[model samples]
Target: MSGLDQRRVLVTGASGTFGRQLCAAFTAAGARVVGVDRQPGSIDGVPVLGCDLTDPATVPPVVAAAVDRLGGLDLLVNNAGVGGPAPAELPPDEVVRQQLEVNLLAAWRTTAAALPALEAARGRVVFVASRMALLPLPLAAAYGVSKRALVAYADALRHEVGTHVGVSVVYPSMVASPIHDSTADAGLSLEGVSRPEPVQGVVAAILRAATARRAPRDVATTRRGRLELAFARHAPTLADRLVRRTVATRIAAGDLDAAPLAAGMLRRHRDATG
Candidate 1:
């Protein structure tokens, strides 16, 4: 009943928390769904192909196969992503590199591979970005940078293929998922800064974007997410001040004290305050 009846959809990161729910929703909406992930398997009766999206060599062929199986591609959901703690003060490391490779480049590669079929079918592409893309928080530089870069990629891609393909980006505030495990293990959990929203909200937003009369340029999964994105877009300076205040308060409360990656930032904040 979502205008997706019999539509052919391909999703990346099919094994993830969001991916599973998204694929299930699409299938229930009467769409034909196929997914690709590092681990190939079936989820909720949808067949998933195995592909290491980061490996440029693997994406094209796997996507081609999925398109073939689906008979034609109506939608491509770039839902794959990784997250971890990486302070901006430190030089870029593996965490940053991996995030960029998966969150930004992999999506780019998958989109490029799916473009031909998508264009043929006049299909849509939905990138599952994060609220961090707009309102970046401290100690998670990798996630913010990569997600912001993903948005940029979506923008440029739209301009080039807008005539033939639809492009949209969905921003989810924060969902309880293994994606945040690394950050939490490092003691940089976003408990106070971000209220976790239900994953179903994100799935619904993406579906709406995909089925809309015109592809929405951007979609936010929650009301607070919309407000945060508006602040970052319309009044960036104030947004920065608000984020800094939150960081300062967290430091004062020793919330980030156990996070080795946040140590440098914490020291600087304490020294300046003292």
Candidate 2:
């Protein structure tokens, strides 16, 4: 029998690409999966509850209600997050706060709400943090900050609860999905960026992390991503410079429109390296 057989999973963002795939994959593994999203959603057969993660008041009630329906929770997948390739210019406080609330605080709130059931069930927590958590890209400042905070929160949670609850954070880099479509529609060219890995690989990694004997502390999907992570962690100066160069080049090519701040960031990285 599969380890995941009969596991009860609560996955947020069930309407998105990864979310839909997660529900299908878990269901295929014989898991009883419940999803929370923000739309009139349908996904083959998964039961989805609509709840805006950004709403503080909605999450606990929504999650409590979902867990009640499931008879308990065995896994809580904190997959609801939003923030895209940001311009180098500082965004409005509203924009930044919105991203922070959704990408970081929502996950924290969801995990807090799920902890009681998870502890009772010895369940797992899977955080879908982006590779931006480590390799902070130039344009996506808000995204990078939120993802990094998510990873940090996961770490702290693991220390607080890992003996009884499995904690894992998946850091997949570039994946071809709806995100790219949105970026493209905004007229941003991701051309010449490393080819995004298949969506299948991304989901597979999440499943593996969720079901591992001992949950991995961190998981990265791409070799390039892992290397970038290493450099960012061990050689921040160099990582900063390389990331800046990439951004500066994109700006020069007109693929990005962040010349002013990108140039300053690049200069700072250079000075820090020297």
User: Compared with the true structure, what per-residue lDDT tens digits does model 2 show for residues 65-163?
Assistant: 889989999999888877655655665466568778988999999999999999999889999998878877655677789999999999999999999
Clashes of 2: 0
lDDT of 1: 0.93
Tell me, by lDDT, which candidate is best: 1
Whole-model lDDT per candidate: 0.93, 0.81
- Cα miss at 157, model 1 (Å)? 0.7
Task: List the candidates' TM-scores in order.
Answer: 0.98, 0.88
Q: In model 1, how large is the Cα lDDT of residue 99?
A: 97
lDDT of 2: 0.81
Worst 10 residues of 2 by lDDT: 256-265
